[model samples]
Target: MAKKKKKDAYIDPQQRELRELIELKKMQQAAAEHPEEVQAEFEKEEPIVPKTFKEKWKNYWYHYKGLTWGGLAGVVLVVWLIKDIFFGPEYDLSVTTATKYMFSALNDSMSSDLASYAEDYNGDGKTDVTYNEITIYLDPEAENVDVQMNAINLQKLMAVFAGGEDLLFVLEQESYDYVCGGKEGIFIDLSALYPDIDIIEGDKLILNDTALGKKMYLNGLEEDVFLCVRDMGGSVKEDDESLSTMERSLDFVENILREEYPDKFPAEEAPADNSSEEAR
Candidate 1:
């Protein structure tokens, strides 16, 4: 049961001030020893230097190595273009060469198809005889020297083969009132083989016959020729007698050409009334 007495503490302001001053001096001395450390700790951080356009471009180039090559490639292409403009494959616009190339392409294509057919004569391994018919057409408006040559070449071939014969070479020229129009041309009617036959006014043969008139229209004679000889309905097999007849007819025609019109072989003529009737 004893009461405790509170002890009064005595404070010294000068001593307290002195202690704070001493602590502050120590901090200053430490800071003075390492100025960079104080600056790094207390100083505001400097903003980073912004990249220049050129430096940025360099960085981009590094990222995309292909871009550098692409620029070089563009320069190389420009140089090549310049070279070609001044010097390139000799600009060949010769009519003769053009004509030659056109005909050569056409003949080559035809020959290739025929060769294929010849190789595959029968379903069995046997060689069957096959004939190729090439028909050329000249456009009335197409006046290139090459086109003329093509027509001439076709005519010559027909003359050489046809002589004075009944062999069919379909060359029908559309008549122009005063001057001959080249609108008319030859066609190989294969409607029998292909039912959808369309007679177009060009050298090429349209392969389908059933599509005739639907896609393209045929002339009267052309339809007859297609229906009579070239179609599946026509007799493809040439018997010995028929072949012999053809040979004789061709020979006779050749003789007639030689005797009558020596210049125009396989020349066409109006049949005599009796002869025409007999022919029909």
Candidate 2:
């Protein structure tokens, strides 16, 4: 049996263990040499996900939660544009105006007149035409007495451009200049609109001029405001092609003042103080 002790080909246990350790050392070296590749492989095996809707909204709100007035003004502009585009096209005409005092009287009179009045465009005995729709906004020329015209936000001014309003009553010269832009076509020339009337004052339109039939001086205001039509003569109704919005506006306001209170005329001269006279 011992004649040739079976020739056995077997590795020692220590040698096998040493071989495994060497393989492990090689793997460690490879991993060390390409750490980013190893990390990428790990990520591929288990990837991260995006946040939920509520989390995103909360993050967005946090971004704009502390915006200033100037930032808010931009938001207002965006909102105005959205509303202008998405809203109904039923409005026949639009007016953009500023001043807290002037708008009150004008808005009241306009709303009343629109509900009760109609014009006979074709003169066929029936004045059953859609009255021009007028919208008024309470925008101010300046935030305060010290604020410059350029410093103002002019949201309502831009609204006119966006809404395509037919009429604009401007109380601030800075806004007027911005809209007109040095004889540009944002506003129709008063001279062209009314050749018979004279509103030009050295190449400028005067608000207190008699061309508007009578001065539309609102009470309690220190200055006068100007009125002008849009450059394109925007109108909502086909019947309004011939109808003059500028002329109608002047007539509407002047006629109301004349018919309603003929006593307030000349507006410059108040009745002599009768009590003072009697006392004298």
Highest-TM-score candidate: 2
lDDT at 262 for candidate 2?
A: 52
Error of 1 at 101 (Å): 10
Q: What stretches of model 2 exceed 4 Å from their correct place?
A: 1-34, 37-41, 48-93, 98-165, 168-170, 184-218, 226-242, 259-280
What is the C-alpha local distance difference test score of candidate 2? 0.49
**Residue 230 lDDT, candidate 2, scale 0-100:** 55
* Candidate 1, 102-143: lDDT as tens digits: 223334443332223223312455333222344344445744
Residue pairs clashing, model 2 = none
lDDT, each prediction: 0.39, 0.49
In order of appearance, the predictions have TM-scores of 0.23, 0.36
